[model samples]
Target: MSSVSIHPTAIVASGARLGANVRIGPYCIVGENVVLDADVELISHVVVEGHTHVGAGTRIYPFASVGHQPQDLKYKGEASRLEIGERCVIREAATLNPGTAAGGMLTKVGNECLIMASAHVAHDTIIGNNVIMANYVGIAGHCRIGDNVTFGGTVVVHQRTRIGAHAFIGAQSMVDGDVIPYGMAVGNRASLAGLNLVGLKRRQFDREAIHRLRAAYRMIFSNEGTLRERTEDAAELFKDDDLVQDVVAFITSASDRPILVPRNGQVASED
Candidate 1:
């Protein structure tokens, strides 16, 4: 007999894979191809369908929808997947969808994440470890969110945007571009306000590293040459500083969208 505790009212397909100590609560549905790792718990009324995999020790609350089809019109029944890493807490009413073929056929949520109630992670989104998406945060398709990033409540990110590691996006912000690592972005359209100093301090980053990152931030955003020039200069000057290097690298990296800059200044190329 299977050691998994599946409620009598739950609908688990015969082909579904359930690991030891997995629990499927009342009225939950696990599809044929779904895989629930060891110690995973579905509270109630959850639906895990398609080719989804829930990692070990993750707990999904009532009414959350995992591994559903993508919302893209281009998705014509491709065999995509949604993969959630270990120890994540998927709160009630959240929905995570699989990727489209153009986005490499996988949507991923990393370890130790807290996806708050009513949040939506769309097709092909890649979320890193220890990330927190507050209630009603909606991440559009193909966005790459780095580790330790936090999105405040009701924030909406545009498709294909890249949010770097340790970035803090304030509540109700509309992110339409790339946010560099350690950056703080706020406002309706979301301008880069400053570095995430409070977050760095709370994470116990070394004093020297934080100081160097601050210096690099100032130089990068100063009213001078183009952002490209500033990024090159910062890369050369702070080559030894790991945190500063991250910021420079993110700026120079090829991206379809423009990088987010302070709203008070123009960030386009300077002649």
Candidate 2:
């Protein structure tokens, strides 16, 4: 708390907690209920409010607004909270809002996340560890984004959408439904294009796992039979692979939107 420099224009509330090695720069506003852990740095003009708790070693750049009131229209000032995990880097102008009471009283962001400039995490969204949200990405209320996910710039997620772990969402994509695990997704009304090979390789997904996932994707989106005809057992050849099992569960579990299909009537992409 005492080691770093704090500018004159910053207003820190008495109830706010600042840990050792924390630096608050010019025009920064820290609200009463805000708690910042050790080694966290805040650049100029950052506003942190509304019962927000930032974990250790996280850095917030200039003009970032965190823990503001939820954007939900049903919100009536209920007691809600926002929690950010350790070692996260929130770039300039990124905005993260707290959760509404109806959507659970707390919104959580996991460790080692990088939220780029102009990105917005709206009310009640749960973002997992090691996730990357590129510039101008917008995630709406009640969305769940899983671990090791990468969102391209300007990708938009609709309310209540769920994107599974290790998925890659392409730039400017509008995602309205659920995206299954280990998939590469893209499009205006977003669809699953193929398996996320880059992500799988980066995460070192085993050959058996990648093979199984590919087979499962083929059955769901490209099989010559109807969805009812293509049962889970049809894709059971790769059932030994947990990642493929993840894909199977996602398709069978989709009671809302149908699992994405390709216009070419094939599962794998040309690329």
Candidate 3:
């Protein structure tokens, strides 16, 4: 293990594992089962408790609470864990809780994620790589957030919702359903606004792929047939288009929450 720096005011339990160049700032508290990987920095007044494992190169700003017991009422002193991936930035006053026995016993935040100030990641939630949650975003328990998803400030997601990769939730939206990959949702009781065209362009998706995805999206959401039938038609029609296939597969998958629809359309549940 490389040299670790501990401020005199910090209280790191003896059983905690600190990797090389880890810095525990003043007034921080690290619990016995906490693991801080190499180059991890707890800026100040941070509390890392429970069986939390923070990956290398992560920075936690002041007043963040990590690896804490879940907010679930059923979580009765279970041995759950919170695993944060490398190079993530957890901003001030963010709360990340561990999973519960009912939901796999692990809460995972993937690499390169940016969780802004006052964001709350609830019990059993799984957040994928490169996700960005703006300030005051609250994700309820058992939610799944895919890679490159971005949430504007103060977005609140209901429990068990699944948001696919590259999706965007506009500020102050209340998300209660599944959001498809590369989709954009907005407004209270969030509805699918459109394709995340800007995100696709920023990610440099080819023009042809974007065009096909748009075409398939229109077909699948059209009023011609049931959603399941439309999804099946899209799957067959866009067999060669990976982007279209991804959306089609997401629609076909079984989920408790309905797939978000356009602002004026009926909710798209499995037909």
Candidate 4:
């Protein structure tokens, strides 16, 4: 391998594809089916196995277990894959599992993600770009995490849940349902607390846009009508607002889980 660096104590198995400038640190183990892109770094004691493809410039910290087989009892060693995007930082002891046949045979983490220590990404989960998961965050199988989402420490998401873009999951939350984009959720069995105003401000959304989104959110969640009716109204009202439309689209999209709402708001109905 030209320009690649493997520590003397590391074991890079035969048939592993190592791109230029890849670094396998001390005691790291890379499996035969693994493909490490250029400038990838597997820090000490990291185990990257199975059919995993780590993108360029990604850094996996010590003791991280990446591309492990699915935890599903139905998984019978299918050739599923774990694909991690570029420039991700996977911290110590984080566990990322590959997909299962039932979940499309792929688990994907998008570019520029920061997975903190002890976080777990289970089989078939799709994490979007620039996402951040704090320590002890456990995402169950088949969850869809949208771009720029942030998870506070110890957040636990149920299987098949979808968290929309820019949503914030507070510490110690147990998310069992779908969360809308730019929403803030907290508490055990999380409910929509409010908009992620801080995130919107930090992301530099204009005041008028934020104001419109806030108005749409209140209208959609108010007790005047069914969630579907409210969402339809919001869709028509915010026709020119992309941000509000995103929330409306997410609400209208087919989902197995209920859309989480504020505790005082009307319950999300299937009709």
Best candidate (score: lDDT): 4
Show model 3 residue runs off by greater than 4 Å.
266-271
Residue-by-residue lDDT tens digits, candidate 3, 1-271 = 4499999999999999999999999999999999999999999999999999999999999999999899888999999999999999999999999999999999999999999999999999999999999999999999999999999999999999999999999999999999999999998999988898899999999999998988888888888878899999999998999998889888888887999988776433321
Candidate number that wins on lDDT, 1 or 4: 4
Alpha-carbon local distance difference test for all models:
0.93, 0.85, 0.93, 0.95
Residue 108, model 3: Cα distance from true site in angstroms: 0.3
lDDT of the structure predicted as candidate 3: 0.93
Cα displacement (angstroms), candidate 4, residue 30, comes to: 0.3
TM value for model 4? 0.97
Model 2 residue 23 CA deviation in Å = 1.3
Please provide, for model 4 over 1-271, each residue's C-alpha lDDT reduced to its tens digit, 9 standing for 90 to 100: 8699999999999999999999999999999999999999998999999999999999999999999888899999999999999999999999999999999999999999999999999999999999999999999999999999999999999999999999999999999999999999998989998899899899999999999998898899998979999999999999999999999999999998999998867433211
Clashing residue pairs found in predicted model 4: none
lDDT of 2 by residue, 1-271 (tens): 5675678999999899888888898999999999998888898899999989999999999999999898888989886999999999999999999988788887899999999999999999899999999999999988888999999999999888888899999999998878877778899988778878888987787877676666667676755778655645645666566776777776676444455555456675724
Considering only N, C-alpha and C atoms within 3 Å, which residue pairs clash in candidate 3? none
